[model samples]
Structure formats: structure tokens, C-alpha cells
Target: GVASVAISKCCQVSDVFTELCIASRTKSKCDALAAKLAPTTRTKITTAQVDADDVQQLCDLINSYKPDLVMNIALPY
Candidate 1:
């Protein structure tokens, strides 16, 4: 929880993060976080429903986003 918030906040302040995708298996949580940060940050925030354990899903997201960086902060349930 702390890590996700902290990272998102960091991204908010830095020019390096022009865009951020806050993905989680629980997409509502990601949406909440994105909503909280969206008003204050210039970073373009988006949310996606994703299962961290699924290789194909992860790969698909990576391919689609083609991000310069990726942070997997998901915890095992």
C-alpha cells in the first residue's frame, strides 16, 4: 500500500514520468488511487485490471503500453 502510494507520488512530482499505468487485479483500487492523484499531478494516470501472476497478461500489457519502465508492486494474496 505504502509503496504504491509513494511511487505514484514520486511520479507526480517528476518530469520523467509523463504517464503512469496503475494496474491491479482489483482495478477499483487502482482507480481510487488514480482519482486521488489525477487532480494534483501532471502525470497521465490510467488503470487496468491485471493478474500479476499471469505471464501472458503481463506480456500483453507490456506490449500494449511499451513503457520505458515498469514497477511491479503487487503483493501475493
Candidate 2:
């Protein structure tokens, strides 16, 4: 995924992102992406399985993470 690769590149610049969570509809894909990005990133990588189509689950995820900022990479088309 472009976002994962791009994020890995961003990490190369500096330790910008301290806690980076990659949540996707496909949990394994998220894990795989993190694994690929791990070696090149200083950011702490975490993975979560999320179905964006689920409103309740999405709310739960946000609360669980309690992120200072949220970047919605999966933009609605």
C-alpha cells in the first residue's frame, strides 16, 4: 500500500510519529504492512483489525486508541 510505504519514508526523516497505528479492514494486511515498514521505521508500529463500514466498531477503535490526531487515509470515494 502506498500509504504504508510513504509512512515508512516519512519515518526515515526523523522520529516524527511516536505511536503509529495501522488499522485496516484486513487485519493481516495491516500486520503485513507493518512488518514491511518496521525495519525502516523508528515509529512504534501497532496493528488493529477494523471494518470501516461498521460505525460502532469505528467508534470503539477511536476510543481505544485515543489518538491526539487522526489521519483518515481511507478517504471516501
Candidate 3:
């Protein structure tokens, strides 16, 4: 939660985060976070449903998004 908030704040303040895709196993959470920050920040936010435990899924998402950077903030527990 804190990681998402911190990253979203950075997106809001800095131009470095021009485009952001918030993906999580629970797509609703990602959508909610994006909706909350979309109005305030210029960062283009998108949400996708992804189960991080699945290597194929993660890889496919990475390939599909083609982002310059990726942040894995979800705890491994």
C-alpha cells in the first residue's frame, strides 16, 4: 500500500513517470488506485489483472506493456 502511494506521489510530482500501468492479481485495486491518482497527475495510468506468482503471466504483461521501467513492490509473502 505504501509503495503504491509513494510511487503514485512520484508520478504526480515528477515528469519521469509519464506513463504508468498498475497491475495486480486483483485488478480492482489497480483500477481504484489509478482512478484516485488519474485526475491529479499527468501520468497516464492503466490497470491490468496479473498474478505475479505466474511467470508466464508476468512475462506476457511485461512484453505487452513494453515499459521503460518496472517496479516490483508487492511483498513475496
Candidate 4:
């Protein structure tokens, strides 16, 4: 999973941040990845369910997390 790879990279270079919020349309998938990352990474990892197409949901998620940066990875379909 790309998410796994991305989270692994974050663990590899975890000096810049103390936490990561993993959100996706599929909450189970996000949670699974977050679980995988949590034990291995020094940085704290959290999971949430979010549908990026929903503006309010996305905004609320961003507001809730207040992340310093967000990486939106999507396929060009």
C-alpha cells in the first residue's frame, strides 16, 4: 500500500514532526496502516475517517487535527 510506504518514509525521517494523522475514505484501511506505523515509528500516529470530496468533512478534519502540513495523494482517474 502506498500509504504504508508513505508512513514508513515518515518514520525514516521522523525528526521534523511528533505526530501523523492518517485519514481516508476507508476508515479500516487507514486504521490498519496507522496500527502498522504506530509500533514501528517514533512519531505518534492517529487515524480518522474522512471523505476528501466532502468539503465540510475535510475542513472539519483539518481543523480537528490542525496538522502543520497535509499530503493529499490521489490517482488521476
Across 1-77, the per-residue lDDT of candidate 1 in tens digits comes to 87577767666675878888888888998888888887788888888988888999999999998889898765556
lDDT of 2 by residue, 1-77 (tens): 57676667656764567778888888998898888878876778888998888999889999999987677777666
lDDT of 2 at 33: 80
> TM-score of the candidate numbered 1?
0.86
Residue pairs in candidate 3 whose N, alpha carbon or C atoms collide under 3 angstroms: none
Off by over 4 Å in 1: none
Per-candidate TM equals 0.86, 0.82, 0.90, 0.88
Which is the winner by TM-score between candidate 3 and candidate 4?
3
- Residue by residue across 1-77, what tens digits does model 3's lDDT show? 77687667768765788888888899998888888887788888889999999999999999999999898987879
* Candidate 2 weakest lDDT stretch, 10 residues: 6-15
TM-score of 3: 0.90
Cα lDDT tens digits, model 4, 1-77, are 67678777987777875788888999898888877777776888888999888999999999999999998876655
Candidate number of the best TM-score: 3
Alpha-carbon local distance difference test for all models: 0.82, 0.80, 0.86, 0.83
Model 4: how far residue 43 lies from native, Å: 0.8
Q: Could you tell me how far off, in angstroms, the CA of residue 20 lies in candidate 1 after the best superposition?
A: 0.3
